[model samples]
Target: MSDISSFGATAKGLAKNPIGIIALFIVLIYGFAALTLGFNPKLEFWERVPLVWFLVLFPVAVLALFGWLVSQHHEKLYAPSDFRTDDIFLKKSQISEKREADFQASNEELDRKILEIVNRLSKEQLEPEKIAKQVAKEVKDATTFIVDGRAFLGRPDAVFTYPIAAFETLGALTDEVYFKLSKSVRPFQYGTTWVLRNESTGDVIRTLRMLTATPPGQPLTDIRTLREVGIHPGNTLVVEPPPC
Candidate 1:
């Protein structure tokens, strides 16, 4: 049904245009002139040719030239439209813009919360007790749990897990103890604990252990019965008397 409508529309458009009518007339006239020239020797022979030959040939040549000219004009008018409706270019641009806006909005909100946390921590002395209080205040609606690795100084055997997104923002929690406690520098690993230094003392005595799982099913506190608990810190032991 749609194809029939499209065909009717095309026919109507062609019927309304003078160029199509004129082209048809020129073709008919050119055909007649060709037939007349074939039989009429007086029109064809240069020496005895009649004025009608020039008259018919001139008009046919002019109309033929106009047909080509009209086609070129039509082509130029419609050519630029080919790229305007491209789905990959225009649609992809819209998708990219939407994603960029969403990302920026999310980053702005996250940054605001991070600034508040950093500002509160900056005002207080860097201590385990105060940091915990600040964390509780800042991260609203998040499940908060504490892992106490009391023996980080001796064996570096504490394990923790935390959300990677939150960790990415906070960067590495560094303190004086981490720099001064041991000459060794252990890189943070996934599903493993790394010592968090007391920012004030640079001591690895008590490190903040994170539960690194995304669904965060890993135990934040050491579960002696569960072997698949949170990852253990490299070269460190979780002290019995947890700091938290």
Candidate 2:
């Protein structure tokens, strides 16, 4: 999830306008000043220096200017406050996402162990269905199944993935899952449309144009209708213009 965009997303963010790009040269200016200082270690280096205080004060002034440039145009160049998805904060998102993925993987592994036990019991002339029902009583909080939604945005053609719970609906896919995917596309509900297509056949399975969050029983985003529309795992959702 942290690999949110292609290379140069940060560069593009800073390149929005001329004023925002001044910060890029800060390091170059400092590098040139250091080269100008020469490599002499003479004892009279301090006294013989021309305006020695410029060395001390100039760096502070340059850093302050850099901070000012970032602050002024941050709204246009940075992610929203909630996501903190600028390049600097992307590492935090990566760490958090790794932890969540590990936790979900652990949950799925536990479910697999239970199924293994059921298979072993069935071989012993015992009723597996009856025992499986008993086992299903536990760990029933909707974490047992996960669906991979390989999603791509139209304009940039950048591909990203979102995990869909087996029980999640179309409304939840956008309003909850995709919304948390990136702050750059926040508030994705307005006039937003999705095309769910078969990965092999390249056929359109479903189309959802959500005006509101998933309602309680709307057919548009219903997970229960997956069988009716031939939706399965690894289906792709293309934003806007669908696909060829």
Candidate 3:
């Protein structure tokens, strides 16, 4: 009875995500079809050929259709408006120049903030609150940094560079801080020792080095959920360089 209840809860949890529901539906359909084909000893040669063909082709077609639907949904959700034409007529050179200028300015500002945090860490007296404030002020986008030698930064309007599952896991670590930051930011690389500090107390909560490509069913120590990390509210998270 207890085992059945636990299985029911697991199924219910999986059903909550549309992707999971779709995947489970596909698996059940395929499994049922396979079982039916295998058990039906009365199937004629012609019938078996067509049935086998249908079974093979149907799932591929369904998966392709699902992919197309997801792509269309993402474009609609995140694509910029085509209605705006103010800069449509601008020359390519002019647009490039403007973008480069903005990128440089943003990069400079980020560098300054990183340096400030480094200096603060070097001090004999470490104030977690001050460190957190400095980081919160500078890190407006939490999705731009490199993790474990892989770049997670995507286009300005992109939902994510990696799988949504990975992002959800990372978000679990960052908590509310992920929501506060912009979804878009300039991409940058970092060393292996990068740590996420509590914005208010400056205590190390997570180490980004643990964010490697973890296999399914494996635990990601660096990207563990907030509950797993045991972080409480009022703790703003900031990415920092390796300790000196």
Candidate 4:
């Protein structure tokens, strides 16, 4: 956010910076000299300077080609990321950073919740017999699964189903988290960390240590399956916002 601002604000900020001023001065001088030499190409100085040297120094045609090349590749190989000037995204880039920050905050909240849950399950709730009583009230199956998506102040929850048998390494099989969240009603905000919780026991089952943990872009196999992470069919999972 330190550098995020409109074009006019950016220009004003740069104007106040000494480094920017020096860069601007250099560019202006180069541009002026190039323009002067460009229109007076037939001047007597041309007799002493090689045409190839002049082209290398100026390179107006080269710059035009560069523009054409960018035009051909834009949106395919490249895209505007400017917070304010991106027309391709319909100015969505302007809010892209804010959304990223919001997602980060959401993930932090989930992590906090996960830590609390872990402490409760391991430290506070020391009685395994008490935990058994709680589970006795709720039946758990080892096969079918239900995951409720929670985005925290975002869109409605998206429910997804998964078969325990298919709970293989998401990093190597199917689309990482999608193989689990694929049945969701809405496409979740990508790149958020995910934490799985057992609704019946209020137990924190799994947590994505990083964004790459469940996503397919980077191949990282999970050593533990859902069952290994304390997931069960009767244990309806609440997927908190942020992950893959």
Candidate 5:
């Protein structure tokens, strides 16, 4: 296994160097040509034997000569002191450190945004309607701005329903009317509002009320609340919200 691995690595190294690859190709072609000429039926038995021996030994001799030449100039071809294995490891370490730093910076920014939102909501004089709008806008901006999960990156417009009961409820609320969710459907949190639209006519259907916890299995699918809305599995909830 080790021998095979070593040979593979050697072959890969040789392939990277065009000169080495060309030399190998030449050797193979010449060896095949030599074998063909050596076996010519017109030659006598004794002559054919010597010819075949020459054909076999000539390539071996050439390969030995190449090895000798390479050995003589091995230091010039690859200066051992110039390249260090430790240098490669050090570079890898630096790259890893940079990635970690970038991740921490992103986390800090998200925390700062959350803190700002909390402080705003805590203000005693803010109206309920204004607070609701602010929360919805924040949720929309956060969902669109920071992409994290598989669904966010790939299908940012669609909301997944099965795992979160809130998403299931949202789907129920928007049924029959054409409505869009944010690029991603986050867990229902205070102050967020999801806008729904009419699918066929591209019109505003209705805006979902401020985000609130609803008991699981509660029927949010009120026909009076939604007009001609249909929610089904595997449907892509539009990402772009309807114009105000």
Candidate 6:
């Protein structure tokens, strides 16, 4: 959820006329000065220096510095409040090349698996049922599964669950999951899911929100159907399930 209440109307009103808003603030400050100082034209330079330069400029400098500090500290926050993302590119790049190469190699393997699945389904003789059997069998044999490109998946014993199903029979992959919404589907509903997996381990590392709400009855099958609803098939939702 976003904090729209404080920002929406205020931003809207300010956006309508930026110059007018600035002018209004200036007028308020001028009015306050007139009431306090009352047109003192003949004051000495020392007195005028205190009033004009020290009092005004000192406060303005302090305010400018304060604003700069706040911006530096709060740069992570954006409009709509709750919407934020981590900027860790520099930090990631600082890691050793060996580690980066390893991650890339894993990603390539995940891609190979996705291509394999798609190619298998495209075969003329194979239908959804066969695909499900093959996929499940393959998953059972393999240590992990790649879902979309965001998450990595591998079966792990209980006590190692860092995320959803960490201890459950459901496997964990090595991909990083990201939560995002899709606008490609119609009649939007919540609980849409997407996954990202490491290319090598076929592990799901990332899970994202699909645009649609959960479908009643059984979970959806076929990546194309998820896309039809404006969600991506990816690796996780792309697989076929046993028929009801």
For 118-211, candidate 5 gives per-residue lDDT tens digits of 6878675687787778766664444332111223236544443331112313334443222233334443321233343333344433333322
Please give each candidate's TM-score.
Answer: 0.20, 0.25, 0.29, 0.29, 0.21, 0.25
Q: Candidate 6 lDDT (Cα, whole model)? A: 0.38
lDDT for every model?
Answer: 0.43, 0.48, 0.49, 0.50, 0.46, 0.38
Best by lDDT: 4
RMSD of 6: 19.5
Clashes in model 3: which pairs?
Answer: 128-201, 128-202, 132-199, 199-236
Which order, best to worst by lDDT? 4, 3, 2, 5, 1, 6
On TM-score, who's better, 2 or 5?
Answer: 2
Runs in model 2 deviating more than 4 A are 1-165, 186-194, 208-224, 234-244
Predicted candidate 6 versus true structure: per-residue lDDT over 121-207, tens digit per residue: 768578878888876654433323233322222223211212221211111121212222233222222223333333344433222
Off by over 4 Å in 1: 1-85, 128-244
Cα lDDT tens digits for candidate 1, 8-89: 6765554555555555566556667666767666654563365465655778788678878777554322222244567535
Instruction: For candidate 5, list the clashing residue pairs, or say none.
Output: 175-229, 176-228, 176-229, 176-230, 177-229, 178-197, 178-199, 179-197
In the range 1-244, model 2's lDDT, one tens digit per residue, is 4564742576566655554466545544665656566554552766536535666777789778768866764434433343544743664444445445655664676578667766766776677677767556434422332222334432343554443333233445445444533543434332333444455566654434432445323444333223334443344544432344
Output the lDDT of residue 116, model 5.
87
How accurate locally is residue 27 in candidate 1, as Cα lDDT from 0 to 100?
54
Q: 1-244 in candidate 4: lDDT tens per residue? A: 5554664575565566444544455556666666666677566765536644654665675467557755753323333432235553553433344334544554565466545555566766568786554444332232456777655324465666665445443222224455555555233323343445568887755434343455424433344445445664545767664433
Give Cα distance to truth, residue 35, candidate 1, Å.
62
Model 5 spans > 4 angstroms off: 1-19, 37-39, 46-50, 75-244
Candidate 6, number of clashes? 48
Model 3 ranges with Cα > 4 A deviation? 1-10, 75-244
Candidate with the larger lDDT of 4 and 6: 4
Instruction: Report the Cα RMSD per candidate.
Output: 24.3, 16.6, 21.5, 18.6, 24.3, 19.5
